[model samples]
Target chain A: MAAEAVLAEAGYAGFTIEQVARRAGAGKPTIYRWWSGKPALLIEIYARQPLDLSGTDTGSLEGDLVAALGRLLAFWRDTPAGEAFTALLVEAQHDHAALEMLRAFLAERSFPLAELFDRAARRGELATDFDLAAGLDLVSGYVWARLLTRRLEDDSRSLSSAARLIARGCLRR
Target chain B: MAAEAVLAEAGYAGFTIEQVARRAGAGKPTIYRWWSGKPALLIEIYARQPLDLSGTDTGSLEGDLVAALGRLLAFWRDTPAGEAFTALLVEAQHDHAALEMLRAFLAERSFPLAELFDRAARRGELATDFDLAAGLDLVSGYVWARLLTRRLEDDSRSLSSAARLIARGCLRR
Candidate 1:
């Protein structure tokens, strides 16, 4: 909690273990005993956030993708956790340890959406041989591109359009 | 040129106008007169790079995309200019001016590729109603995602795969 507060107030550059220790009223050794370093502590804070990955079936892959993406967009726009996540991602670029931690976090976060693709395949909604991972990359990549560029407005139009395109690409031939 | 060397050597965090002025043997005021700040100088450096956007026709959109993306990947990996560009992108997060400069830079760089899409539509290879801008976002977004995440290997496999997917998505009904 103290870490999150520090991260919010000071951002990635100003966030230091010492500051967190001071804010939390805990000794440096105690903090280190629980987490290896800043990246690890940040990961712990991120993992504790309430991310609702409970996807909607909607009886079609397109619906599932739109819903999933909508939730993702909302998560980023409506939550402090989202800002923390972006901060972590930005920090990760400068630190290899943070990059590794962020990679693991992203993989875990993407699991539920992977299941949506799996379900689509089972229902014969997806093409006979869709590259599920690549599809995920395109979908998520578009969202991330918009987010990083500050083009992601609080509307679902772009997300809906992206989902439609991806669905068409993945549809059964 | 001096700014680029300094950027490569010191990275975004270490990059400063004073250091660049010192390295270039130019007064800080002169540098400021030529360019508003570090971000402006970096964007100028990037815009001056010889990015060959002359995509090959190869009689197919997929081929055009693969060739363009291959050249892009090479430009990033083979040149120090790539490091400067990455540094600029990273720095853009903290500076509103840098972010604005980056957005303009990206738009200009993407123009030739938009023309490629236009050509494909004229050839009846793509849907008449294809969303050229959205399509561009998806294609470029996938490439950027791979590059930013460091998943872009030297091989052309990912580029080829992404091009194929985009081509399919843009095909006329």
Candidate 2:
């Protein structure tokens, strides 16, 4: 929580262990005992945020994707999750280690998404030749762009439109 | 050119009029006369880079989208364009004015993309209810995610796959 507070106030440049420790009224060694460093701390803070991906089992992939995007956009817009993730991405741009950590975090987060696609396949909704990774990339990429560009406020019309496109793309003809 | 060379070498933090002038053997005043500051200079240099969207006229929307993405990914991968744009994004993260410029630049860049979609409609390839702006966002967002994550090296297999999904989504059912 102190780390998040510090990150929110000072951004990547000002997010020092000393600052977080100062804010939390805890000793530096105590913070270090829990996490290795800044990137680790950031990840831990971010990972705690709930991404309600439970809607994946919904009847159709298009419905599933739109629901997922709806929850995701709202989560990013209404919570600290968006700020924390944006900080992580900005940090990744400058620090190689942070970039690796961010990539790994993103890859790990894809499991639920992968399941969504797998369920679609089981229902015979997805095209036989669909590349799972590429489809996932487009969906995630769309969300990341909205997050970074601060356009998440546009909401359902745009999202459902996007979902329609992705669904059609991955759908069995 | 000097600005790009400076940016490529030192990145956003070190990109300044003084450095660009020194790199070019020109005076700071001359550089000032040419451009307002770092963000403007970065945009100018980037705008000069050719993004060949002429392939839009290709008969099939899928073919056109694939060719456009192929050229875009290559342009971002092989030239200083990627570095300049990335630096712009990083700068935008920290500076409000830079962020505004980046937003405007991105909006301006969407023209050719709109044309690509409009051409698809003329060809009777796209869905009647398709949202052109949302469709553009997905394609550009996919490319941006690949660039920002340093995954541009994966080449045609991934890009053509992405193109296929986007094209299918927009296709008339």
How does each model score on TM-score?
A: 0.92, 0.91
Residue pairs with backbone atoms closer than 3 Å in model 2 (clashes): none
C-alpha RMSD of candidate 1: 2.0
In Å, residue B41's CA in model 1 sits off its true spot by 2.0
Candidate 1 lDDT by residue in tens digits, A53-165: 67488888888988888877777666556556666767676677878887887788788788989888889987775787778788878877776776646656666767777
Off-target runs (Cα >4 Å) in candidate 1 are A27-29
Best by TM-score: 1
**DockQ of the two-chain complex in candidate 1:** 0.56
Listing candidates in order, what is each one's chain A TM-score?
0.89, 0.91
CAPRI-style grade of the A/B interface in model 2:
medium
